[model samples]
Target: MRCEIPILLRCCFCFPLRYGLLVWAYLKQISSISFSTVMIIKLCHDYYRIQASGAVISSLIILLMILDIAFNVLFIISAHKKDYKKMRIFYRYSIAVLCLNVAIVGFCIAMYAYYVYVAPIMIIFIWSFMVPTLVMIIVMVFLQGYLIILVRSEFIKLKNNSQFEFVNHGADEKCTANLDFVKEIPGTV
Candidate 1:
């Protein structure tokens, strides 16, 4: 049971699940916006602007998240192919994505926190959803850090082993073709 815990945690923190949850969270927020909510936005000048801005901002953020998810999927493919350079690039990009997300979510949370005091009703839709999503993202970022370390170590190990094997077996002349290119050239011969 103790040994199974890490595997369980890994599954929970996997890219598919994380990406799905993020999509679900965003969709939930979008779906909750009803006709009444639109009417309220039109009734109040301040809310109309805020709602429009938030809508645009969230849409951009969601697009970024989708791109991040696509990059992660590519990263997984590169890892499987043992392409170390691609893995490095993709992994670095993943970290950048995570940082950008942290910044975006943190800023939104701070805004929500301020609004919580200033306008409780204004924050109602976001507080419960965004808070938990932020926590999950934070956890995923940490998990990704650990995964990056593991990938780096594995890549290094694989590289060294390949080098060692090459040094041991790659030097045997008998194991390779004995024909010299110079001798094989008809005119030169």
Candidate 2:
């Protein structure tokens, strides 16, 4: 049998709006702020040696991040309102932002590879960070696909059951779908 804790935690964590907000916070704090600050510091210390226009690229990345944050906030609001059509549109926008982020990460990786193989220049910061960035980007792309699948399944469930009942397991195995005493998310109950 599947562990109840994992299932409960997964269900809670898979709540799309909350997940979007968590991702937004991470991107704002770690990727946009800390990462950019360190890169800027590196550029300032080695302006002549690092000739890859790091400042311009970082600015573009920051702009993309800002767009992503805006999309995520809009998605959270739509989800909260239980407006299916609006949620779908905002989710698509989030997916597009993820695609752009993946592209930017890929470009950064390619630049690192070029510096290593073609240019014979060793930018320590770029080389050091590219690996982790690539891995995270790949994971984010997969997550985007997973979220799409989950949303599609939820749509089907909503269509088949007009009541939109959702079961919440709390210290019990019995399905709560039809239980009047069981509380659930507003739109799904």
TM-scores, all candidates, are: 0.47, 0.48
- Model number with the top lDDT: 2
Residues 1-189, candidate 2: write the lDDT tens digits: 775211122223555533554454355445545655665566577767655676677656656656655665555564455456655676577567667767877797778778888666566756667778778888877766556555444434433545657787785766556556646656755
Per-residue lDDT of candidate 1, residues 119-176 (tens digit): 8897777778877887887886776555555555545544554565425665665754
Question: After superposing candidate 2, which stretches have Cα over 4 Å from the reference?
Answer: 1-59, 119-126, 155-189
Count steric clashes of candidate 1.
0
Report every candidate's CA lDDT: 0.57, 0.59
Rate residue 10 of model 2 by lDDT. Answer: 27
The collision pairs in model 2 are none
Model 2 residue 71 lDDT score: 60
Best by TM-score: 2
